[model samples]
Target: MSISTSAAPDTGRGPAEHDVRTQIIEAATAHFSHYGYDKTTVSDLAKAIGFSKAYIYKFFSSKQAIGEVICANCLGQIERDVLDALEGVQAPPERLRLLFTVIVASSLRLFFQDRRLYEIAVAAATDDWPSVQAYKHRIHQLVEEIIQAGRAAGVFESGTPLGNTSRAVYQVLVPYLNPVTLPHVSALHAEAPEALYQLVLRSLAPPA
Candidate 1:
């Protein structure tokens, strides 16, 4: 959940400067929520926040920069939720199932309940924003971790290299995870997670 302070305004380090940066982000998020990311502009944000466009520029280089922070925050919440759901679950099989279920549910909730914010997510994915790339890498790592644990427990076959297996599994989850792809597959949304999880489990099963 740690956002890179590198994105912070060049203003000197202090509580006051920090507050100003936060104010800009908060204001931008609210504006984007109301008007949608594509329709909003830095000038519009400055007007809303009562700061000049130049002042706002000191904090963020572009509209996408501000969106990146908001997108990171949203994706961070999903990662936290996934971690919380996995907490205290010792069984890799169950953990894998929960991972699929929780992520899909969380994503669907965001798409349905917060369409405006979801617009930002869609932009992030389409534009190949750094935050979205980092999120995908983390999710891939989580899958690899679960696969490694499964191998240790002898519940999953070790014949396939771990990297290949994990990547294959992650690819299967991409349609559900990628904001841009999720809507296209909406018809399968309800049943795909469980069906995919079973298919993955079978693939990972030890040979007879």
Candidate 2:
């Protein structure tokens, strides 16, 4: 007598596994959009995805963990837009200009197109989300690259350390980039981006 055996569950990132994960993320995005992150729960996510809560647990540890992934995905898209915009810019100043413009435009578009995406971004800024810092660091890295390019080209002065300078640049734009403040800013002035961008450029200028 032989015992019947079944294949183990697909746990890897094979096509089938990837498809299921994508489905979950999509459903989670919709739920978070309609209900807001604070109101969304693991059970709601699983139900919306047509999977058991235990099934979601098998992949993600908690509801917050899933939200963090969604935030990271949005940041990844923003990074791609920044890189794409920078490609045609020949000068560092121009690269910096495009970087700020593209990001602001992209953020506004994302917020207006689906305010839920912006809400998740706001959580990243206001709450101490674990994965949020990584995305912020990635953004700062892009800014530093442009600064370094400018220094090499003799277009700008770099008296301070590049790392410190980059941090200052990103921090100063908190109002414009921080999802928490971004909407308010936009609400007051729809065309405030160019004005804010001027301030960004001034920050990078060498002291006289």
Candidate 3:
């Protein structure tokens, strides 16, 4: 009886397929973050992770597929956090505070520590990626939902357009979430993220 000790290459299938896919995603995310999407290639990722190009191909049909997964993960995380903040919070004002605190802290972590991933995700999002756009729309909906809830609960003044305020908050916070943008905004406002968070809150604050 001959003993076969060589392990099979990853094919991204079967019961453990999810785990293999996750591994591939992690490796590809790091590569894309470091070298950027345009500069990074499937070959580079395979080489970096000691996997055969064929194995990677089996997992992801192309680099774009991997990028889609990364984008989905990023957006899903943000949605989850926002939803979590909204749940079990009675007061609309308190809900807004919780949401902003969670989001700002999360953004700070992503911008400062995982900047490469942030950059890669942001780039992928703007290049006509459908998944990216959908994810973004979901975030917009989250903001809109918060604004609507606040209005209905009488926490935000009536006649104020929640949609417009949602858009404003998104536009203002999105760019500042970038580390590069942080310094520029920080100098202007001093406390940067904190100030921006407060500014958004004040803008939405109900009368007196």
Candidate 4:
């Protein structure tokens, strides 16, 4: 019987494959954070992980694929944090405020610390990838829940379908939440986040 030394590229196919893939993602995240996505190469990653360049290819198809994995992990973390903050909050407006504050602060931090993840996120958004679309859709639903809650509590405007109003809010906040525009937003420092948050809240509320 001949012994095979080569292992095929697989994702979640087996413990061996999953472990290798996880190792690759963890190592790739560090390299990308330090050198950025554009500058980091598969060979560099393989060298860091003590694997051959071909072995890195066994788990990830390209640098972009690896970046996507990183972005997913990072965004999932933010999502979990956001959901945790929303728990046990009875006031809709208060919940919305907390949501935006955490989102802006976390996004800014993510941009500074792991810009490679943000860069790949922007690219994914630009390309309109399905996974990204689903991600955004899920986020949109969460925000929509808040909007609906606010409407029920009489803190937000009524008569419009919740989806329409929530989507409009999402569009306005896209500058802050969308990775493609994050760099541009970071360049400006004219207004405080509280000011921006209040402005967004005002847009949703009816005149006194």
Q: Top TM-score: which candidate number?
A: 1
lDDT of each: 0.84, 0.70, 0.64, 0.70
| TM-score of model number 3 | 0.69
lDDT of 1 at 74: 78
Candidate 2 per-residue C-alpha lDDT over 31-135 given as tens digits, one digit per residue, 9 for 90 to 100: 988998888898999888889998887666677666666776676666677789888778988887777778887777765677766677777778847556776
Put the candidates in TM-score order, highest first: 1, 2, 4, 3
**Each prediction's TM-score versus the true structure:** 0.90, 0.81, 0.69, 0.78
- What lDDT is obtained when candidate 3 is compared to the true structure? 0.64
lDDT for each residue of candidate 3 in 123-201, tens digit (9 for 90 to 100): 6645746665675566667667777887888767656676778898777666644334544553444345566667877
Q: Local error of candidate 4 at 36, Å? A: 2.5
Clashing pairs for model 3 are none
lDDT of prediction 4: 0.70
Candidate 2 deviant stretches above 4 angstroms:
1-17, 188-191, 199-203, 206-208
TM-score of 1: 0.90
**Overall local distance difference test of candidate 1:** 0.84
Off by over 4 Å in 3: 1-19, 33-38, 48-55, 125-128, 177-183, 186-208
Worst 10 residues of 4 by lDDT: 1-10
